[model samples]
Every structure is written in C-alpha cells, then in structure tokens.
Target: MKAFFLDAAVTLTLTAAITTMAACVGPGAEAGTVTKGKIYASEAAMDAPLYLYENNHAEEGGKTFSRSRYSDPQGKALVEEEVIYEAGKLKQHTYVQHQTEERGTIDVNDGKVYYVFINAKGTKTGSDKWNDDMLLPDMLGQRIADNWELLNAGENLKVRFLALEVQDNFGFKIFKEGESTFQGKPVVDLAMKATGFFVALAAPSFKFAVEKEAPHRLLKMDGRL
Candidate 1:
C-alpha cells in the first residue's frame, strides 16, 4: 500500500512497515477485541474485568465515527471521542481525557486528521493524513514487522501506534502456556496496548478475558512512561 512519511525534519527519526492496501478489512475482523501491545485499548486482567474492542467501521474514504467515554462500563457516555475512518479502517482518533480546568476544547485545524505530540509544547508531532498512517508497510499484520521494530527496541524513544477491529483480524494470536486463574477464572499471559496513541505499556504479563459482565478501570494518564 502507498503511504506518506513526515520529513526527517519533523521528528528526526525513521521507521517503516507494510500497511493495509486501501484499508482492506482482514479476515474475521468485524467486532472489537482489545489486546495488549505497544499501544491499544486492551482488556484488563486483574482490574474489574474492564474490556474494550476495536470494531469495523465505514467503507472507503473519509468516514466519521463517534466514541463515548462513560461512567457505566456500557451505558451513558460522559465524554465523546470523534474518530475518522478511511477505506473501512481507522485513520484518526481524538478524545479529550478530562473536562477539568486543565483541559480545553481540542480542535483539528489545518486539514490534519489525527494528531499527537511527544513533547510538552506539542512540538513533536505525528499524523494520520493522506498517506500518513502511523502503521507503515508490513506493520499491520499477524506478526509485528518492520518500522515498529524501533518501538520495541529504543529506550527514551517513545512511539504510539493505531490498530483496528480486534475480532479475528484484530485480536491477539495469544496462546496459553499453562492452566491459570485470575479473579477466579482462566487467565493467560497477555499484553495490551492502543493502536492510535503515543503510549506504550507492558501490562505486567496477565491472563484476563472480557466478561461483558465487568467494568473497565481508568488508568492515570498524566505521567511519563
């Protein structure tokens, strides 16, 4: 698939990967299946069985989506996240974490779709514009390949990636090494992360499953990784 890269002058780093060809939906990826990795909305193992899933969206071109942050695990939303889709896949996502005085309205200006900054003044940035998808060629497949290699290697060199529906094409190819129990249920060694944010978490190797029956815990989002 063809992709655009930010000039070296923008972030001063380089990484590459194989991307989806025109947002082709992978086999069996119609529902949400949150898993662990460099970045994603993963199902919590020990917490209140909180779960999140990335599901399939629109088809072809600029399609918009709405995400709601709620007080109930599956109820009335307290906050909303406006997301954009391209070729049936997620292109950009933005949500105001808090409505406190420390926050304000986040506006997407200058034709930019997705945005993020690794710096305080929002100096360092990334995008999800035309040919500017975060996961590059070979990066959005069964095995984590190319480009994102640095993300698993570099220290102090932080990265944020975006991933789509976690049904079959999106859930983890996780395997169980032995029988285990977490919260009185079967648990397995698992990793979780978001696909579209600038945060990486190694979630203390877990064995948790989604219990449409539980709630999600909020992680404190204002500290260094």
Candidate 2:
C-alpha cells in the first residue's frame, strides 16, 4: 500500500464500509502519470520479486485515471483489477471471485484474492467468527483441532495448511489465535498464504513470482498469539 492520491492505510480504514478496497503489494510500485505513458519506479518495490519478476509494472503518482495495455495469449488486452489493501490488518483481498477482469497488465475489479497474510497460527486474521465461508466441513474442522502445531499453548495459537475445494492452485496459510470478535461474539484470524501458482490460475500464464521463508512468506505475526 503506497501513499499516492490517498494514504492507502488511512483511506482503507476511513472507507471501511466501501466494501471495495484495493489490495496490492509490489517490489517498487508506480502509478498512472499525467503525461500519457509516463511512469516511475521506487527502489524498494523494485527489490521484491513480487514486483520485479512479474515483468510488468504500473507507474505511481500523477493522473488518478490512466490506462496502459498488456496482452494475453489470444492477443487480447489484459484488464488487471485493483488490489484491495488494509492497514494494521492481516490480509487485503485484492481479487474477489465474484468480480474481476484483466486489463493492460492491471486488474479492473477489486475482488481477487491472490494472496493472504497470516499470523503464526492457522486462524485467519481479523475474521474470527467461523462459518460456511471458511470452506471447512465438520470432519476437516476436527482435523484442524487435532493436528494444528501450537506456537503458543497459552493463547491457543496454532498453524495448519490445507488444499482448497477446487484445488485451482489456490491455498491459504492460517494463523488461528483462539477466538476474537468482529461485529460481535467471537472470531479468528485465519491469515491464508497463496503462491504464484494462484496467479496463473486466475490469469492463465500471467507470469508472477513469490518468496517463502522463515518469517517473510510464512510469519509468526506480531499479535497476542
């Protein structure tokens, strides 16, 4: 999240009810420019493989609305969607399944979940009240309760990885830190991690890269857990 037209973090929280927040990350990201096709790149976003290896970039700053073009296999102009990001939060769902289309190496809609950020445990961040949206069955939930690797026995923090329902190169690494609350009652922060394989699944052959490690990709988050 960069602070260009809007402070991504501040805007996100203020627009909490917007329901459509851009979730995005890059090595060194740029934005649309005033002059047609003008661009820039920061040193930091450039260093990360997520932005570097992708082999495409968008300029930061300048015109709020500008369009560039990247192509697809059938020579179609790819319409990239806006990445939804959050602040002081675990995961920012950039792509949602319900609304998405590619354009010029940019995603148009703000509903695509290519990646998820997790704490140490297996529970999802922020969202604690488990329900059908968790994509878990009675038996699977039992397995999670049984085999989860506990990082903090006191907080009941544990971790687990599972294959998805469709198995379409998509997965989430969870950081379950006991029970918390969202609207009310209790909930958990299941920060799911995704891989480049997911990118390709969403945008066939949509070249991308990801790095996994002790604390970078997989993390023991700074939470009560």
Candidate 3:
C-alpha cells in the first residue's frame, strides 16, 4: 500500500492502529471505530506531539463516513473534517479551520469535482475533472492496504492525489524504501514523493511503516498530518 502526507512540508506519525477503536456509535447504527494519532514537528524529534488527531469512522446505507478532529495540546480545536465514500471512491469532503474560520467542501460527481470555500472575505468556488484513480488524503491508508501485494513485490507505483486545499491534483510516486523495526515490531518501509518537476524540488518526500505481516496495518507515517 502507498502512503501520502497532508501538506507540502508538515509531518504526521501514526502511533496506533485504526482498528483500535477508541469509541463507538450510538444504537441502531453500525458500530463506529476511532483511531488517534499524533502530529510531530519533524521525524527527528518525535519526543512529543505538537498536535493530536482523532478519526471516527462508521458505515451506513452502503456508504462509509469519517469525521476527523485535530486539536492542540490543550484540546483546543484547530480543524475538523468529514469525508464520505461510496464503494471506496470519494463522494464528499468538508472541513473547517477554526482558527481562521475558513470552511470548504469538495464534492465528486459524474467524473468531475466541485469545490467551494467560505471565509471572512467571501465565498470562492471552482471545479476540476475527477480522474478515476485520484486519491484523497483520507484515502491514502486504504489505498496502501488495497495495493499491498504490488508494493510488497517491489513495484514502484505512480498515482494522482487530490489536494483539497488547492482544489487540484498532483502526481506522486510511491516505492518501497526498505524493511525495518518500529515500536519493536517488524515493518516494511515505504516512501512517496511528488512527481511534478517543481513539486519534486519543493515538496519533501514522506515515509510510512507498515506491518510486514498480513493486513499490513500502518505503524507510522513521517510527514505532515
């Protein structure tokens, strides 16, 4: 599986597995799962997390839903995002930046993506063609899990990932970096970088560690959250 980071330079570290649910949904609905992770300033100093993230996932009516919240050390909300998917494809994503009061939404429809942003100034909107294989930040983990075999075989894969903040897509290449031990468990290391000329020079490469065993659960990600 392939892993992608959030911003051009930020870093994220997955300290736990997504299946390790921290909470559950209410009655009459499928049980929800919660995964929590920490955001670090850099990989070299993971001694403490600069921020914390929690993702809650649930399924209903053939569709999957996820809500993620990011907060500072004191628990002050920074950003909140919600994503919906159908059959493993993005359906909609909406987020709000509490500090800036910036809100946005990305919707996929009929091979196209529609985006809208609202802030102190006013509302801005745009659209872009949706590529069939385009990946979103929230989909990275699943994509990696789904393509584990190809990655394990040493295949370097190229993918187009949607950058919701810019309402555009960027090219990226994912390759196996090597094998290592993380948190005392054996893991397969993978790395990804921007493929575009200018992006390749400016964007820092990201790394991921996944279990070497079956299911290949993500152990850590060294890049922006």
Best by lDDT: 3
- Model 3 lDDT, residue 102, Cα: 88
Residues 51-151, model 1: lDDT tens digits = 22122333323443433232224433333344444444444544443332111222233554333422233433344333333332112321222222332
Off by over 4 Å in 3: 1-31, 43-48
For residues 1-225, write the lDDT of model 3, one tens digit per residue. 112222212122353211111111111123376666555555555676677777777888988888888788688998888878877678998889899998898899999999898889888888888886676666766677778889989998777876656667788888898999986889999988888987777656767787898657666765532
TM-score of each: 0.31, 0.20, 0.81
The ten-residue window of minimal lDDT in model 3 covers 19-28
Q: Is candidate 2 or candidate 3 better by lDDT?
A: 3
- Model 1 misplaced stretches (Cα beyond 4 Å): 1-66, 72-78, 101-189, 192-203, 210-225
Checking candidate 3 for backbone clashes, the offending pairs are: 1-144, 2-144, 10-224, 11-223, 11-224, 12-223
The whole-model C-alpha lDDT of candidate 2 against the native structure comes to 0.23
Which ten-residue region of model 1 has the weakest summed lDDT? 216-225
